[model samples]
Target: MASPADDKESTPLLFSPKGGGHLDPANNGVSDGPRRRAAPPPQPLETHYFASKFDPPQIAKVSTNSSKYRSENLATPIVKKIYSSYSIIKDAIQPMTKPSLADEKRQGKIYYEDTYNDLPWRCSCGTHHKDGIWLNHSDKAGLVMSSLVWLMIVYAGFTVTLLVNNNSLPSHVGVIYCTLCALALASHAKTALTDPGSIPKRAIPNEDNASDPTVKFCNLCETYKPPKSHHCRICDRCISGMDHHCPWMNNCIGTANLKHFFLFLIYVWTASAYALVIFGMNYFLCNSEECIFPTGLVALVRLMTFMCVGALIFTSNMLMSVFWGIMTGMGTIDRMKKQEDKTFDESEEEPMAFTDIFGIGSYFTWFLPIDPIFNDYDSVMGYSNAERLQRERSTLV
Candidate 1:
């Protein structure tokens, strides 16, 4: 027999059908010849195309950007004066604050640097307070708005009823309608008077308080603001757990007074509906009772006025309440959809929940103006009942 090395050298190499290359089994099936691959097809123009970042020749292009630059750099004395005048207009309109906001700021300044208790000095910064003059701040504005709504409600239901629909209804029903209307007004007034909730002014961060949670800075307020607080354009101060500003209430709806706000909405809506029924009865009596309508231009004017009141009230409050309900229902769903659309970092605040709207399971309390057991800021700040109890116990211990 031949030696193993000679035998291996003499062994015939296998041929591969791929372009007739000699396959080397010993070389793990690699080709002995220089490998050839099919030439790649040419790429389309799109593949080769690229946008050039270089600007066109300066003489060739007169860009809109240049005009923007020119306008921004306009700093003549006349322009400065014009800008100053515009700024005054802007200051007059932008971010209307609570009445005597300057005095409020002074109070906050006194307590802004709470040393021992890092918790919000809510009395100093919170919206709920009775110290100011009667019907000032949110109260004054709300009073005006509520007064308007009440006047409409009363005029539509009670006054119009007295004029036209009153005789049609029994005494007790009329009394009930009047009472409901009055209660709605009272609820609205209470909602206005109540403080929604305010964010405490934060302690100035320094060597000692740099790491404190309550040392947040508000760019708008030019001071430290607490967590879960934001500046209200209407209130012109930071509100704690603020939901939104209601022009109808002329106030910010926030943590402390949302209960009252919800109650006001419900009562007003009910009152509006009751008024609508009264108006409907007047129309029904006009058509059904075959009653002789009041004669003379003055009486005729009163009749027309009653009809208009009913129609207007129906449009403003009844339909408006329906629209409000739709809007309110959509709010949470929209927030959830937006949350789904966004990819937030770990640090961002969460989207407001349906539960945050004040009612899901507890309809009784939600329908009325009564406060829930967990409606306070402590609860709003994500404190679970168990966690709160545990923290309390720990503090005691």
Candidate 2:
């Protein structure tokens, strides 16, 4: 009853041709050619949200394989890249901000307290106060180990001397051996008891000389640091011409005590070598039947032999290291830090270097455990006595 154009308009097409085929309502919502099922209703897209600023922005992901929603997820990678770049930029600039005082305290950046305060004994040395002959009380383990080493040395020396006395060896041989042991013990004591040229705690640099290249600030000690000086955490102080901290000595090897440390090595090596030679000769030359050793004596001899061998090996290596350091004009710390002494001229300064550590005296004196005499003692201390006097005068004024 209706025209084809009128019929098409009145038919109310449920599906377009682009959607596969047109559906006719007149055929009960069925396709004109073949029947086609109705498409399901569109579901809501799932979205992921990130809490951090550095994380990617929220993105919707459709369950269906629709390209339209997939295009939205593409922006997620770009947004993430932007956030990551911003985070990196922020981190790079954060350190530029000066830290507050509270921040420093929280981070353990506060200045250290006076190292010598409340000590049992203190002595005035020229313009500064120094600790007495007592070993460092802070390090109990080091103290115990050092005591054990001293006892071992004494025991070994006694045993060796007794062996020499009982044997047909000359009394002078025993005397010389005892002298070597005494020297070694003395040197060890000097090394342990002497202050390793510790810089005065809380020493302030003169305002006029604040720009001096040799004067630097120590954050931990909160004091002026002299050239070639370093902070020893164990000693809790700055040491002038710091070489290394020796746990065996329960002290640091620095400008003041380096000579004693070196001499200790020398004497220990000499004594150990002497003992080994004497022990060897007594064992090989003496008749086993006539030269009978008691069980306790034999045990003591074996222990001394072990001690001698260990001392020989350790002292030899340490001596070589000291020689190397002298030749190069560098300390263990300097070598470790790879800091080269620009002023060092090996050929010309070699003799001077020896004197610097051992003091200005006879070569024999260098081998003795004695305080070194520097040409410029004030220079070794990092500040001149003249400067101190001037500062004092100004303060008085």
Candidate 3:
């Protein structure tokens, strides 16, 4: 220790003023050395890139204090409301934009192209048909045969009701003949117009059952054929439970229209028989004086007689074949192929088999031209793949 004044003079100052040197008492509190300018206040990092050739490239430092960037990030009340509204609208319209698989299936638009586009007509039960009303453009022979049958019916009806005996036939006789003819025509129309249980082209029951041995693929229709379905060349499609192509009706007899076909045969046969019996009664039982006939009338009668006989023979054979098929549980095609016949125990199974074709309905309804109760896409196919699997599982247990 020195004295306090000497010690203060010897001690170095921690901070200098604007000048580089400390204050000196001999200079009257002024900086002793050269005066130095003040260093500028520290500026923001504006000059980020290095312009010197020797220096490496430097990354530009971004300022977080930018008004433009800050405005974008700011969540005002309007922005929040707009974002919430956009989210709600997106959620609301998502369902209509993306339909579910079950909804598509119910619309009948799944897997297959629109077949009803070209076919504008629908049946009584809302089934689409390519052939409108009664005409089949593909079968000219059927058209000719159908026309001939109609001609026969008209001629026979006219002869029995109005021409024979100068329209002296009883009102009930005409009524009966007309009723039979009407029923026959109705059944015929129904048979001709009804779809023959056609399978949808390119329909696949299941992707998993692709390897199943029983599921046969049709090259022509490009579809998997279900059990008992056959490809009909005339119809140019696969028909479920196909019996045969009928020239008279100009339609394939199959699961959907077989009932109408059977009824057609029955009504035609009854009408023909009634006409024949009436003709016989008028000709054979009448007195010669009372029933004298003109040469033209006699010729007409003879021609109609032959027609009646022919119709009787044709209808009888068809009825027999139909009955055989019903009893044997085989269609005409199945019978022709000689597939192993299913034995018919008439006592126990006949009614079931009969009702299977005609439908489980009142006896009176069976004769009428009505749609079959079980005639549908699912029923015609017997069962779906899932149902079939379930049935097999149940049977195994």
Error of 1 at 49 (Å): 99
| Residue clash pairs of candidate 1 | 97-235, 128-195
What C-alpha lDDT, on a 0 to 100 scale, does residue 257 get in candidate 3?
88
Question: Where's the lowest-lDDT run of ten residues in candidate 1?
Answer: 7-16
| Model 1 lDDT per residue over 1-397, tens place | 6664323321112221323334467764443331222332232222111333333244455565797656656657669899999999999987553334346566773212212222234333224332331122545665576567766666645553554452545567667767766666766665666666554343332333335665666776665554445677666666655656676666666665665666666665565566556556666556655333344333643654564555456446534543343344322223344469885232443444435545444766565554444533344532223233434446566
Per-residue alpha-carbon lDDT of candidate 2 for residues 289-331, written as tens digits (9 for 90 to 100): 5466656689888888999999899899999888877777667
Ranking of all candidate structures by their TM-score, best first = 3, 2, 1
TM agreement with the true structure for every prediction = 0.45, 0.59, 0.59
Q: Give the CA lDDT, 0 to 100, for residue 185 in model 2.
A: 89
Q: Could you tell me which 10 consecutive residues in candidate 2 have the lowest summed lDDT?
A: 9-18
Alpha-carbon RMSD, each predicted model: 26.7, 20.3, 19.0
Output the lDDT of residue 388, model 2: 55
Name model 1 segments beyond 4 Å from true: 1-143, 160-166, 202-216, 220-228, 284-377, 381-397
Candidates sorted by lDDT, descending order?
Answer: 2, 3, 1
Q: Candidate 3: deviation at residue 61, Å?
A: 85
Instruction: Report clashes for each candidate as comma-separated counts.
Output: 2, 0, 0
- 1 versus 3: better TM-score goes to: 3
**Global local distance difference test of model 2:** 0.70
Residue 208 displacement (Å), model 1: 24
